[model samples]
Target chain A: MNKIIFYNIFRFIVLVFIQVVLLKNISLYNLNMPLLYILFIFLLPFNTPNWLLFFLSFTIGLTVDIFSDTLGLNAAACTIMAFLRVFYISITVQSERLETEVTPNLSTMGFRWFFFYTLLITFLHHFFLFFLEVFDFTAIINILIRATLSTLFTVFLIFTAEFLVYRKKVR
Target chain B: MNNLWRFISKYNALFLFIIFFVTSIILFIRNNDFQRVSTLNTSNQVVGVFYSKVNNVIKYIHLDTVNKELVAENMLLRNQLKASHFNDSVVVNTVTDTINRVQYQYIAAEVINKSVNSRNNYITINRGSKHGIQKGMGVICPTGVVGIVWNVSPDFATIQSVLHQDTKITSSIEGTPYFGPLIWDGENSQIATLTDIPNQINLKKGTKISTSGLSVTFPKGIAVGTVLKAGVKGGGSFLNISVKLATNFYALQYVYVVKNIFATEQQDLENLNKTQGNE
Candidate 1:
């Protein structure tokens, strides 16, 4: 438990640093921005308490918000994502499987499951974030374009990061 | 009451979610309002220091371009010096000129962090209240107008960039009385929309748009942009003008925060007018 806490703390610091310092400057044609920091929420332990999960998500989102000067935009999106994450996990992952798997990652969850999980959550997060930032219906098409492009870009980055750390199981 | 307590305990997660979500939404609304209560923002000391430290390293990568821009601006300033031009007017023994009292003072600052891709972009600068920076001051780059100082901390300040949705600058076409508010449509960073210029006034491509000095925020006749296109929209009487912004937000580095020295006096007189008119 102590090790897990330390790992998460380290991950939080590294992810926020990379997000604000490095990834913050990179935008594909001033449209797509990869928000790989969301991976911190996704990689949390499967058995993390629902309340703890929500709190962690909110904290990370608020941290990003502070750095980006968006205030509560990311916080609102992240809370909604956390709520949906709880619902999604309850329906999909069985209690028996949770005992063996320490956390959800490419190796533990398999490619297809992990892909869909990141895709759905990321899309929803981006959709909410962009629409909320714009706060208008007239630019719905532009918002949709941005959300879709950014979602794909972020998912690609997540997959690349996951592959770098992928380890084959010696059964 | 017991049943209600039991129900609440059972759905505590939902209640927590609602609470957190509502709090965030409230925060978002408060942030969107014109006057923001600054806290937990980029202007905060910790966040500002971190960004500036990081920018100190990153700024080197653009050293070549930044140097060129500074050199170009230096040339422009050098040309305006008295030595650059022969004395065109008759040399008169001049006393201290009482006619032109300095109305504006500029403070130099460096951009530590900024985001242009977002719908409402903001810039964080190194100088803040400690350097005599304040909110509502106009910030401009060598090329053109940049933004307004929105929030100020002791050592850092955040600027509401021209690319923001709520940002509107009172501007006019060069050599014409027709003026309107310049706004960003959130589509392209390079392009902004100028509204309320009547169709009766003929506009042409490449016509320069400049600050009209109508608002107290910015000074008079600063280069804003050049007209890219102009036309009537949906049978409206006003010509919808698109302007190519002069300031390249992507390459922004240095800026000048313009402080109007007589702003308080001007505002006080305006307020007095309002009170007397009401009677």
Candidate 2:
């Protein structure tokens, strides 16, 4: 468990630095497509307590908030997504215990369940983030387009990275 | 102490995380004094180097715009020179300070940092206490007011660009002595709104918006912008005006920092008048 935690910590640092420095500049057609480093919150040990999940999620959001320079916006979005993740996992994963140190890959939950789980949570996150940044929904089409594009882009990257990270099927 | 250390170690990551995050937030909130000085110093040392490189590249691309502005200013100078009282020595007092109540004292600067895309934007200039730049001094491009100085170090100052949500200046539509606090809604940088304007005022589109003497930061009659639209909001006695700013913030490369020579004295006078009259 300590080793898993340590590895995740290392990855989090790399992801945040890259997200702020390099990937932030890769805005293609008003679409700043970043597969959030917050995916670690999604990958935390299945047995981690609920309050800890909330607190950790707040921490993650606050860190991103500090770097992004927008106060409270990203924190709110991330905390909500963190709260929703347990439900997302519960509905998709029927297995009694997530025994291995590995992440909940498609091999564990299967392709259908994994896609739904990632899609639902990623959509929830992007929706909150986009609208909060804009602050008003008068231009609904613009918000919808941003939400759709960013969510699709994030979903694509998460799936591709997950596939490469853990290739073996669930036992 | 041992028990506390053990408790901390049990949740060391969480403890550390909360500590860093709260520290940043507090630093962000209480950001105007010595903490602001340190932030400006650190950012200037780091970003100054980065911007020096960017400035080298920018200098080549901006020559045409710079030349055009200089030529226009030259023409303006010539026009002012033809005015009968263009005498050199007394001219500083009689003409430059002719604007009612407010006196203009300029601090020269070169723009080292400018960002227009962000919601809360600021421009950093290469002059500070070493060159008489001070907090609350109004900053202006050759065309019009860009922002007000919010932070200053010995060698640099960061302006709270008029584009920021925090910007509030006294502005009036030309021809009316009446004025109100003009501010940006933190949405688009190009447009700002004038609040507290009486609904009965006969203002039209294209009415030039200029600084009112109500602020010591800027002199009276300096160009602010032109009104683009006007309307009375829901059951309010004040008119809402959309003003198109005169300065092109995206292209601001150089500016003059205007200091109020009698800011403190005038502030005291204003306070005295209010306090004495109120009682």
Candidate 3:
């Protein structure tokens, strides 16, 4: 348990740094902005307490928010994503497997489950992020396109990072 | 009591989520106001110091571009000085010596952090109140207008870039007396919309757009952009003029904060006029 906590703490710091110092500068023809910090929320232990999940997600979002100079947009998006992850996991994973599953990663969860799970949560987070960031209904189409492109880019990066970190798939 | 406790514990996550989410939304909205001091903005000391340190190292990578821009600005300044010298000689021979009073002062600052991808963009500069930087001052690059100082701290300031939705600047087409408010449509950083231009005036493509100087924020003839396209709006007497902004926001490094000497006097007079009109 202590080892898992230590690993998560280190992961949080690394992801935040990468997102701020590296990813924030990358814009592919000004179409997509991949926000990879949300990956921290996605990789939490399977049976972590819900309240703790919400708190941790908010903290990470706020930290990113501070670096990006966006006061609350990230916090709102991450909190909702954390809240929704509970439902997303419950419906997808079997009850009997919940006890045995260590964490939802590229190695622990099958490719199909992990891919779809990351996609859905990332899409939701990006959509909400762009929505609040724009806060204007007149540019709905612009918001949608930006959200979709960013979601795709973020999910692709997350998948690549997961594969690189965990060499072999357990499932 | 037991039932209440059970319900609270059962739905703890939902309650926590709502609380956190609502607080964040409030902060987002409140921080958007020009008058508010955003805790997370780079103007804050901790954030400002970190960004400045990072920028100090990264700026070396763009030294060539920065040098070229500086050289161009230097040439322009030298030409202006030569013209001013010629005028001074003319004044020296005049019967009545006209004293030239300076109205605006420029405070140089370096951009430590900036964003162009978001709908509402902001740039953080290294100068702050300690350097005489203040909210409502105009920030301009060597080539064109950049933004307005929205918040200021002791050592840094945040500029609400013209790319933001709420930002509007008074601009006019070159060689024409007509003026309108320039606004960003949030689609592209390079393009902005100039509205409230009367439909009767024909604006040709490539016409120069510049600061109207109707407000104290900017002086007359400061380069803003050129007319990319112009068309009539659906049900208005105005033309929707598209302008290609002159400043490349992505490559912005150095800027000047324009301090209008008569801003307070102008604002006070306007307020007095409004009150008198109400009566």
Candidate 2 local lDDT, A1-171, one digit each (tens) = 788778778867866655544454344454445646667676677666656766777666665554444445556676667667766765655556644455665666577867887788888887877776666768567767777887888788777778777657454
* TM-score: model 3, chain A: 0.95
Taking candidate 1, what TM-score does its chain B reach relative to the real chain B?
0.93
lDDT for each residue of candidate 3 in B77-96, tens digit (9 for 90 to 100): 88788465634333444345
Sorted by lDDT, highest first, which candidate order results?
A: 1, 3, 2
Supply the TM-score of chain A against the true chain A for every candidate structure.
0.95, 0.88, 0.95
Fnat per model, in the order given? 0.70, 0.00, 0.66
> Across residues B95-190, which tens digit of lDDT does each residue of candidate 1 receive?
898998999999999999999888899999999899999889999998899999999998999999999988999998999998999999888889
Q: Considering chain A alone, report the TM-score of candidate 2 relative to the true chain A.
A: 0.88
Off by over 4 Å in 1: A99-101, B1-12, B88-94
lDDT of residue B147 for candidate 1: 91
Give all candidate RMSDs, comma-separated. Answer: 1.9, 7.0, 2.4
Ranking by TM-score: 1, 3, 2
Better candidate number, 1 or 2, judged by DockQ: 1
Q: List the residue pairs that clash in candidate 2.
A: none
After superposition, the stretches of candidate 2 with alpha carbons farther than 4 Å from their true spots are A1-171, B1-44, B47-66, B82-102, B114-119, B274-279
| TM-score, one value per model | 0.95, 0.65, 0.94
DockQ agreement of candidate 1 with the native complex: 0.75
lDDT accuracy of residue B103 in candidate 1: 95
Off by over 4 Å in 3: A96-101, A169-171, B83-98
Q: Regarding TM-score, does 1 or 2 come out ahead?
A: 1
Output the better candidate (2/3) by lDDT: 3
